[model samples]
Target chain A: MRENLLDVENLTIKYKVKNGNLFFNRYREFKAIDQVSFNIGPSETLGLVGESGCGKSSLARAIVKLVGLDSGKVTWLGKDWTSSHASTDRKFRENLQLVFQDPLASLNPRMTVSEIISEPLENYRKDLSVLEKIELVKKSMETVGLSTSMINRYPHEFSGGQCQRIGIARAIILKPKLIICDEPVSALDVSIQAQVINLLKDLQKRFSIALLFISHDLSVVKHISDRVMVLYLGRIMEIANVNDLFSNPSHPYSQALLSAIPIPDPIREKERKRDNLVGDAPSPIFPPSGCVFRTRCKKSTNICSIKEPREKIVKLGHRVACHHVSDEESK
Target chain B: MNRLLEIKDLSVVFDTPDGSVKAVNNISLDVDRGECLAIVGESGSGKSQTFLTAMGLLADNGRSAGIINLNGSDLLNMQRNDLNKLRGNRIAMIFQDPMTALTPHMKVGEQIREVLDHHQGLGKKAACEIIREMFNKVNIPEPDRRMEMYPHELSGGLRQRVMIAMALICKPDVIIADEPTTALDVTVQAQIMDLLNEIKTEIGAAIILITHDLGVVAGIADRVAVMYAGSIVESGEVFDIFYNTKHPYTLGLLNCSLSLEKKIDFLEAIDGHPPNPNNLPNGCPFNPRCKNVRDICREEKPEIKIKKQNHSSACHFELGVK
Candidate 1:
């Protein structure tokens, strides 16, 4: 069996919010991530999908040590590195890279494309000379489909798609073992989004790097990911292989999310029955008592509201967190 | 033949430091009563600018030349005050971002009341009654409580519902929804699309939906018009545009979208990015990226020509008959 490259165990993240102005100062903790756990094997793409404010971004940030974890551990290559000091550790920073959403906003406006792509090498590779760094930058640019001639151009000069290519080039420059891409193509147009998705796939195959792909768009996730994980209100609802999760989703939330996506084909779209979950996601600050998704879940019952469902292995690799689903599987 | 809104040879130009930017080129289309016409394009494709000109909402530096006729009356030449009277009364516009479109300081109920007061000259009690009904029609729960809340206090989906309510409060003949559901999540987007479909059938108002999502367009729009670099490359029935595509750009868009039906190994992405509006290619804006480009494509621009019944394509050659 292939060993896991990254393992997250019972990871919990929280943010403190200050309520009641002026005289009475009251601070409350908002639990953004609730004991979420998953693992990614080397060279595998694990797609994390959830709606806005569902803690997908919080979880990604927590993994990279960009955000503090209140509880639990993040194991990298079978080594525990959950301490605050890990953020500054050279080995951790070099092996784990991140590609952000809003390509233009993520890149430094004043810096040239070359500077942005080679910034990692400057920090991590002190042994390399300036000339070597320049050569590496050029090669990285070519790998991401950017011409070396445009290396001196600023982020504002390039289009959104090209700007995204620059972002990809920077993430792949260090040849990291794992890269977490947070909504990388959501800001792009449909045609341009396809270009960036294809580029990521190509780079992944070439470098054999594991990816923690986070996105709200399910169709894009389905296209690029090897395995998929569904999150609802900061908790894992289901995780399985790409085909098994999409074809035979065990969790109710997974089924609703899949049905909500409108297929491009008109005839198929018309025939598809949509079981849309009503109402917006509840605020994480005041989430439902038992299950975080009980407020919006269609299949919720008294047991779903009384006690939180434990994660159960439905099949060899598929795991789901729903009381009814697990009961049916056991029966 | 009973077209409620007709635009003829319309062009929008904006004066900028770089030069005059042709936002929307000479394009003509019409919408019949109770029909939905979708304008699909990427950013800067001028889908939004087309209706902005129709509503007299273009910026000060922008200039438009064409006939915008509504019910046989030319709107381009009308006075600002006259146009203002017709705007919320006869034609209503729903913006992409409902939060910004709505008044933040004012209460949600008062915002809708202001529209009815200005357009219909209704009394306070009458307007309040209509506002409550409008809120319920759009499926906003607890109309009384929601009406008292501020715009920021509501969720994205509810804010959009309020925008739809305000648009419907006027009972306008033409409803132009510009990317109404783009800011919403998938489930909420489905809800909003379903709401729009319900409004189209019940109110029988001509709806013009401006969006980039082809899936949303296919589900709701009766007809589809595709734009590329300020020109309509193709306009047809939804079935024709999706299945029997003509323009290369349109084909590229359909091919590029990741399908939820089946997994595709490699997406056939369009070769290059969209051309800069300031420095578009001479003949056809899409010729540089077209796979079947010929010598003539770089010399003469092709006008939109009808290829089949209710289907038009702006291409030099027939799609499949090279």
Candidate 2:
């Protein structure tokens, strides 16, 4: 079996929000991410799929230490790094990188492409000379399909796809073992998205880098992920291999989400058996007791509201969290 | 042809400091009553600008020249007062972001009532009754309670429903929904699309859907117009666009999209980025990225030629998605 590059256990995150009524000094805790646990192996991709405001971003941030973790244990290469500080955990910081959702906003407009790409080098590669840094930047730009001569140009001069290439270049310049691509290609066109996704796959093959690809799109996630995790209201609904998850989704939420995706073929779209969620997700602040998705589940029962269901193995490796899900769900 | 809305040779050019950028080139299409025609393209493809110009909404520096004949009336050359009288009555627009389109300070019911008030001159009680009925028709639960709430108090899905209710309040002959579901989640997008399809059948009004997603087009649109660099590269029935796509750009688009219905190890991506509008290539705007581009493609542009009974393409070579 491949070695685990990263492991997370019982990760829980909460934010403090003031009650709307000002008559009393009272604050409530909003659980952004509940006790979630998952792992990624070397050179493997763990796809995180969820709707907006579902705590996918929060969990990613917590892993890289961008946000403060309320309680959790994140182990990096068999070492605990969750409570570690930035100055002391330089190796961990250098090894994990982030590619943001908005290409234009994530990149600095005033900074040149070379400078934006080389910033990580400056932070982590003080040992390399100016010539070595320039050589490395040129090679990295070429790896992402950008011309070496365009390094001196600014971000505003490039298109959305080119800007995202710059972002990927910056993330990979350090040769980080793990790259957290948060909706990396969602901002680009379909053709451009294909280009970027292919680039990421090629780079991963060359560098053997594990990817934490987060996106709301089921189709894009299924394209590049080794395993997929479904999140709802700060909790995991299901986690399975990409093929198993897409073909035989066990959780009711997963079934509904997969069905809601608009297939490209007209005949397939018309003939597909669609399972739509009844309504929008309830507020994260007041998430329902027991199962977070019980309010929207089609097979919801009295037991769903009274008791929280733990993760159960539905297949050889697939696990799902739902009271209504049975072994028959995998069939 | 019994077309409700017909646009001929529609072009939009923005006078910029650098140069005049052609946002929408000489493009033409039509919509019939009780049918949905979707214009699908990338961000800079000018699909939205084509319909925006029809609604008499263009930036100060932009100029448009086209024959937008709606029910035999030239909407492009119509006087401002006359067009204003028809707008929100015979033709309405739904923007991408419902929050910005809706007034935050006003109640949802009053905002919808204003449409009926201005167009039909209905009394307050009469307007409220019709507005509440519209809310119910759009599947908004607790119509009375929702009518009193502000835009922020409602969810993203609900707010879009209110916008649709307002747009259909006057029962326009044509409704231009520009990327209406782009901002919503997938589940919510399905809900909104289902609601829209239901309403279209009930009202028998033509729908012009502008979006960048081909998946959405496959689900709801009867006909598809694939736009590239401000011009329509392909126009055909939805079946033709999905199953028998002809244009190189359309083929590239169909090949690149990831599918949940099937698994693909790799994607056949188009090589280069879309050309800049101000400095587009001389021949085919997509020649820079087309794999089968020839020397002649660099010298001259091709016009939209008929491919089938109801299908047309604007490509020099015979390109098809395999």
Candidate 2 docking band: high
Write one digit per residue (lDDT tens) for candidate 2, span B1-322.
6699999999999999998999999999999999999999999899888988898988899999989999989999999999999899999999899999999999999898888888999999999889888888988989999999999999999999999999999999999999999989999999998888887798899999998888888888999999999999999999998888789888889889888866777789999888889899999889899988889889889899998999999988787332
lDDT of 1 at B216: 92
Error of 2 at A167 (Å): 0.4
> Any residue pairs clashing in model 2, and if so which?
none
lDDT of 1 by residue, B246-318 (tens): 9999999999988777688889999898888888899988999999999999999999999999999999999
Superposed model 1: Cα runs more than 4 Å off = A84-88
List the candidates' TM-scores in order: 0.98, 0.98
iRMSD of all candidate structures = 0.8, 0.9
**Model 2: runs farther than 4 Å from truth?**
A327-331, B320-322
DockQ, Cα level, model 1? 0.82
